[model samples]
Target: MATEELNAIEIEIARNRLSSIAEEVGSALIRTAYSPNIKDRRDCSAGLYAPDGTLISQAEHIPLHLGLMPTMIANAIAEYGAENIREGDVLMTNNPYIGGSHLPDVCVISPLFYDGELIALVATMAHHVDVGGIAPGSMATHATEIFQEGIRIPTMRLFAAGQIQSEVLALLMMNIRTAEKTRGDLIAQVSANRLGLRRIHELVDDWGVDGFHRACDSLLSYSERRTRAAITKLPDGTGTFTDYLEHNGLYAAEIPITATVTVAGDQVTVDLSETADQVDGAVNCSYAVARSCAAYVLKVLADPTLPSNAGLTRPIEVITRPGSLVHAEFPAPVAHGNTQTSQRVVDTIFGAFNEFTEHLVPAASSGSMSIVTIGGIDPKNGTYYSYVETYGGGQGANPDGPGASATHTHMSNTKNTPCEVIEREYPLRVERYEIVRNSGGSGLYRGGEGLRRSLTLTRGKATVVAGTSRVATRPWGLNGGGDGGPARVEARTNGEVRELESMGSLQVGVDGTVTIQTAGGGGYGEPEAGR
Candidate 1:
């Protein structure tokens, strides 16, 4: 099959088939995982790639992971040498400097072969519950360097020639607290990739190798053409906006993040050179994470329905200064940046677009993921347990209608762990879970509301870490609308209550309770006179 012979129908069919394979692998991972983080919250992603490491298709999972996985796989291949890669070889890495978001987000890559030739690659990334650090969850708020975060695995082989490396597996399990759960999740990731490999081989068998290659090329070309056309629709101009983070995990001083978006004839460029330098805390991000945030904003402003392949990002360029907050250098703590700083990057980029795009974008939402991690010994079973979950907030209101309440938005696409799962798996209880009324900004079209959740320790001691933002600054509104409320965290132990900072940690005894109240979204327009 020649390039000219591949029709639109063939391209569409190939696109759907590839996307289905990615989604299937993701579902397999979620079902087979053991930890509540992966099994209950679904904090994982899967994707299919070309032999040369170009992203072809991905499940509609985590925006941050989906964008960064390609870079991690490409870097792994480069470091290990593509020629040295053999069939049944599964590569693994979680080094942020080498295109990973953090240490806990372990990535595994495997090559798919047909007729003794490399045809494609299948990859999956899962966030383990514990990876050995100052804290059990590997997301410490006070860590000043990468060594305190977790075990850093460079590009290496976890599986060779279809054989698991027991030595390597044993070394990894020895460093983490929750060895059993982590081992289970790691096996689940491997199984998910194996499934993807089989599905890809079947696709090749049906379409033939030549036909499959042609279809993939056609799909990439189609996405590139559509993206360029979408850029042409937006007026050629430049927009700039700057936002702030409440703290850098170690200080109360605000850190600034600025984005400048420039739209030309058929391309867009996002510049973060004006952003502040990386701090000595865990609020910095890798360059790949920065690029993902920029790409996500472009997709939201342009046609979002466009297939999320390498071609979709071909028309966009991201510029960042080395050693900056958005592009941290080696050894800088970055566990919190993957979730917390990523949200601010999206907000700053969208705010820049709204500056000159005729107000096409919506107002700001609760700019935080509100991560909570608890680690302790289960008294009933005398086993270690690490519980990690991210709480959702409000969605920004648009010109068309009001925003939705109590939902995850931008950079995070994970579900909350069910109360029953929490009670069944750990020594904790969900005492209170409800929406915070009047938290949304008042306007003609009101913003979305936030929520409050409280958890109590059942019968053991534990270490708890709470991370969030927008506690000092409100979510900005558009077109004279009101700003939204801020976030709050508190802890109560032995009849004494104490407030916690935006990024804080504490040791809790039995019967202690930790409460989290997320922020709300901004309104769309000015409010009417008192009704």
Candidate 2:
């Protein structure tokens, strides 16, 4: 009769049913997206939230996107005014200043209603290959302002009265270089949200809208309680760690990322104001990403098992100087800011958490997750084109097993494109993809192995961008474990090697070997700690 009146078995069954819906949402989005990042790599997230923006359930999508949705939703509602949102209207935006990471990561949201009453918001987010920026792809390292970053869509209707708005679609087409592919992806997102919404409404029919809402609240509150309990188990004190970047895009500036964490029983205060100032380049992070990175540190170190909701975030607070590298100002090119800085920020948080619980947090991960943004004419169709892809490195080792080979670190939940897909989509061939033997750090539990991939061009021209770490500093292991291998990229232009960035694009005529080697993760504990 009532939510609390249900027995434990009843509650468990309800939870599973809700989980099934989350899975359905994920499947629909994955099936609908156009890019490898979503269709195969699965670089997206789907979740069910209470009307008040608390997590009810989520499909096991990405760790990063899943973690940020609740906060992002709250901010979105505030921007659009929840009361003004209509039943058949959908809202979309990629404003980093509001709550997104970058323009490429566009989010679409819609309200679910039954009997003319609000039930929940069905939301889906995907990373489009291009979002109409200065560069063909939105990830431009040379551009120093947000204007060059890409399309910045404010919270407005992409769909209205259940019909696709032609004006909104036309505006997108007018700005982006690759209008067709971008428009296709946009339609796919709208479709995914509608599918998710239909499923949510079905859920309401089974559970009643009010009952569903109440259950969401209870689950999120429960998650908060569980996380607090875990925090209380740890010692109350302060911990800190610092990491560095190779350099800013403009000048030779080795940016420093410092995280100071105060663990007072169950609550954490993460202060990043002491870090280096903002750059004249595109290495600045928005506050949403900065907060998400802070939350990521907690997930890796404190209690990953704690349900991912606003409740788990209740124990943590992230403080950054408004205009620092970690917290960039508006119009500052931030396309690459969050990914580059957040990786080090996660490492810094790990460094701090290591002091509070040495057994839980291991050494650093393969520090670099590079991107290769290619641009040129599509050889097959002679169309101007751009593609942004991810490269995998080795992962840090843990107590039970070694890290996986060739993986994306931190917030990334994307997969490497299948060789077949790469061949079909672009004018490049992945000459080789293999694990680099002995790349893992040496320990009882060795660090994961790094990878090496060779890209050969068949097109008239292409750009190969590299953003790698461990080229200067290797992945540091914990306790007495050995460090992982270094990161290096060699470009043989008629057989001449050159240096690379963990985050820059390159242009090649044809038949170029862009060799990328990723760093491995750090090991955990002393070699004999497990023994």
Candidate 3:
């Protein structure tokens, strides 16, 4: 009898197993990483790809990072030439123009070979605390060019032919403020990919190389079919919406992120060609980011149980113009683009989709990552230290119930750094850590509340960079609901208190205090009469 073809049960099992491999890769990266950004906050992603550079499966990690990996793999393969990628060779990159979201996020890809034939690739992307730029954390707010953001890595062999490239390694560590930490995290990424490669070998052995490839192809097609069916459920029409960034770091001007979502039959197109031009600040985003946000919105709106892969992207078409905020070109500073601007893109798409699915979509969420980076020497230990963390804000209110309070949503899903960890790791103290009550918008379903966090310098001067949003414009509510509170940043030095811009840098002298009050989510629906 001929071997049976793949059935629904077999396809489902293959999908789960593939996703399990990706999840294990993520777990290894977190447990072995050096920086709190990766270990504690969990700002990293892992995925498995077919030899032809298609996304097979990914761990449920940062949405922005996960959505951008397929292109990164394709670019890497093109630059290195598929025939040249041998066993034990790993490629790396973080240049936004070269299929990356930003500089701090580094992508590592390792090819898997079975019976002298390349079968698959395992990839991982992590946010290193430092990569050597104008700032200690490499996330400078006012940098006008990508060079100032950090060292841009092209598609090159980080590890060639089973040998670690020491020159490449030294060149990377030489530029960043936290060399040891960066090096440690990079090594952890390599190890994570190696672990994933080992698992892939085991899987291929169990199913045979041909059988494994067949399973991947079948699952990818299944995901596409499911996504197309979900799109057909929406009313065929056009929905347009626009959201704004309070300001890019260089100037105080409203930057618009607009999207016109058109759903025709079983296809969806998100047109972002109407967004503002690229600004002379670190707020510019790349094409990958725009595509990622658009795909993310559809993923959330579609079936909740849809398995994530390249197939999920098949039914969606994303349109963006070059030199625009959503699809910036080379050398455009985009440190804030990945974190701050990406959030607004998601909100804009959701806003447009809400026109047709009001009950399904939530009100606006905290439209920023509220990123803060602090670095200096620890006077007590005489060792250098750099800390980068993104604070949690309000999540949008949904029809099902109230929004989640003090949480990271959408493109970013990092956990808050524990107050105790902050103090123990660096020369600082958490002065205040509490929820800002009444910050969320009011309606039948209340939005989530933001957080109030204050940090005091215990000793030694430190440089502080704040890249936040939702200051001038507040999170929007829906159907007669009230808007949420605005974001605020302030500094108090030597008995003098002054307000701060949403995007800027400052020096925190000893005993000086910096406070950040994040924005809340938007409420959903009109308030009911009486109690």
Model 3 has an lDDT value of 0.89
For residues 102-131, write the lDDT of model 1, one tens digit per residue.
Answer: 889999888998888888999999999999
User: What is the TM-score ranking, best to worst?
Assistant: 1, 3, 2
Q: What number of clashing residue pairs does each candidate have, in the order they appear?
A: 0, 7, 1
| Residues forming the 10-long window of minimal summed lDDT in candidate 3 | 1-10
- Each model's C-alpha lDDT? 0.90, 0.75, 0.89
lDDT of 1: 0.90
lDDT of 2 by residue, 1-531 (tens): 235534445546666777777778778878877776678777777777766566677777766577667767778778888888788998888887776777888888878888988778877777787887666677777778888878788888988778889988898888887777778777787777778788877777887866776566666567677787888877788887888877575544678888888888778899998888878777777777778888877776666676666777878888989888887778777777655666777888788777766567766788755666777677778786766776777788876677777888787767888988877787778888898888888787888888887777776876665566667778888877789988777776666778675556667877766878777777655676553
Clashing pairs in 3: 132-176
Off by over 4 Å in 2: 1-11, 525-531
TM-score result, candidate 1? 0.98
Task: Work out the TM-score per prediction.
Answer: 0.98, 0.94, 0.98
Per-residue error (Å), model 1, residue 195: 0.7
If both were scored by TM-score, which would come out higher, candidate 1 or candidate 2? 1
